[model samples]
Target: MSNFARVRPIGRRRDGRPIYPIKGGSPTLTEQRDEVMRLLQDENYDGDVAELLQRAERIAGEIELAQQREARLRHLRGLTPPGDPDPNPGQRQQPGNQPDNGIPDPVSAAEAFVRSEALRAFRERGLRGESGAVEFRAAPAGTVTTTTQPQQNTRVPGIIPQNPDFPLLVASLLDRQTSDGTTLEYMRDTSGPQSTWNKAAVVAEGADKPKSGPFTFDLISTSLKTVAHWVPITRQAADDNGQLMGYINGRLTYGLEYKMDREILTGNGTTEMQGILTTPGIGTYQPGSGSTDPKLITVRKAKTQGELALYPPTAVVMNPMDWQDIELDEDANGQFRVIANVTDPGAPTRLWGLVVVTTVAMTAGTALLGGFRTGATLWERQGITILMTDSHADYFTANTLVVLAERRANVAVHTPAAFVKITFAALP
Candidate 1:
């Protein structure tokens, strides 16, 4: 952030040529570096070449120290991951370890597995073809290389490892928890407070208190189910490309999330997670007979039903097509209705003051609005774990390996009334 001065010509040579030499003013480290460059390059510089050279050496040391300090600050502020420590002050990162392509080295889990002892042993004992695929190991971790100049102006490609994880839409909206057991047992209230909460009345003195019907509840026990998929790739691909390995792992994990998201809203209880729509006793909303209600109006009406049930809906889950219509819906003046900060993107998807999850998970012409974070919970028994094995179904002989990714999870809807499933259809 410091405004370092550019190098200025100090004086003129005897023949009137401009002469640039070290001057008295306090120059910035960068400016000092420029002075050093001038002293080395200019034959007519007045200062002593040897003493000035010594000062130049000190300036170089300062520049290196400054770079390391900046890197450390960036790490502390969470700009980038930490790198190997500098053993000595002002020393450059080791020559043989740094990458020529200027990418900061980050060890992803899949890459870690490839570099692990287990994979190495597998490579040694397992089959090989011709000279066999050589095991490729990434060089020692490199520090993030950045410059003070703007990215567009910097000559070196300033690259860093971007987070490869997917933005979980539905999963992120749900209340997620870790479970130790295979089955999750939770009580779902049927009557809740609406029908069974009128018992408490004002009773004076020793008058007998009126007893109302007890709130009904059903013991819901849902078993953790596995959602998984696998991909087959050659041993050569796995060993040679760590980035590819990470890419596969990230995508596989995302696949599990995608299915889980769909299941949370539509899965039949017998097979998978008990979806909110399929769960019994939840409120339902539909347009009146022969009444034409737009999606914007339909969502508001559904939200009111949830509120009337004494559960304020937190989010609305709709098919992308439905939301597309809503976003593009025009008023009488033809102005597009939903202005979602399109000019300044990255806004959270929202509608009617509730979070909107627009995914293919929900059936077209239908929507579900719910207090998902409170009405239901997602229990993850085992998170997404990736495993590669060449021993599956003669894959070992075929020189192929299967990368299996899976997770064990279940959904529990505690208060069914806290959700409302809307059928965007008119009574026929």
Candidate 2:
């Protein structure tokens, strides 16, 4: 047979390297060994042909090991392989043939073969719904009892696939709580958003002139919101698929987390939770008239706003693109403005005494500065959860499983004035 006869090309890489999909169930050791020998006999083979022979040898070795394991398993389970006849067919075992141990011989070889065949059918067609029927014939009386061992469970290498890089979220940097209560309630002073200090004048003994009124308070509330997404996968894919599950679940979790982060920064309070940017009466800042670098001005204004509200801003969140612009900004002399020197150690994540969080969630031309722990709270009803079920419509009949990943949380900014939103021109 031609060397490439059994191999079917699946696709090619960008560089045109041919890719082949592995086909067929596990082969017998003798078949694998013979294939390897045939490849070895090709003396005129070059580098690629030699590589093929090497792969065949490796496969042969694996098959031999598998056969040994199969034999051991068969011995333990009292199953018989084809061509191996049990001395007793359908008759009850004689005491002489029976072991002293009370346990009777496992299932007869025929029963084992039937089970094996059924399992093979399940693996091949049950997942695809090609055939759901299984049939078996009774072994004739006095027929030899054969033993067949089940297949060993061999784990595939590289079970964990490489994951795509996901944007790190700043949501965790803020104050978080596992809320037992569904809604967040806090008291807000209505008399004024901020507290004022009054200086007492040195006057007469019984000065009853100045009258101070009690501060008015209003209760503020925000409800917890649920964020979720679902992926529908064939039940076969969920079970038989190895590395693929890792990739799918990881990507799904990352996607959900990134969305939550963005919502905390910009979610509108209609059906979704209200975010810091949408929080009523939050602070705002604008860049100075002539300054090319807005980092300094941004931090100053935001910090000043929070300080004015009696809450000092502790973190700055901006888009990666904007941070890049700031980091690469040059002065008249061609020297970097943000980095002190060329050898500046790590990625500059700190600026103007505030922890800088660079994420794509923030708009390209906008930034948010806030005293996260003091101004707002993240109440998590449920963390990221993953589950698989066929309950989705028609999925049970269709052999499909729904992989759901979801989170329930809400962002409540009790002191909106303690946060600041800075909008600037989009960098070129």
The candidate scoring highest on TM-score is 1
Candidate 1 lDDT by residue in tens digits, 356-383:
7778998888998988766887777754
Worst 10 residues of 1 by lDDT: 150-159
Off by over 4 Å in 1: 1-117, 120-168, 193-213, 426-428
Per-model TM values vs. the true structure: 0.63, 0.53
Give the CA lDDT, 0 to 100, for residue 187 in model 1: 86
Clashing pairs in 1: none
List, residue by residue over 360-388, the lDDT tens digit for candidate 2: 88888888987777677666765455544
Residue-pair clashes per prediction, in order, are 0, 8
Q: How many backbone clashes does candidate 2 have?
A: 8
For every candidate, C-alpha RMSD to the true structure in Å = 17.7, 26.6
lDDT of 1: 0.67
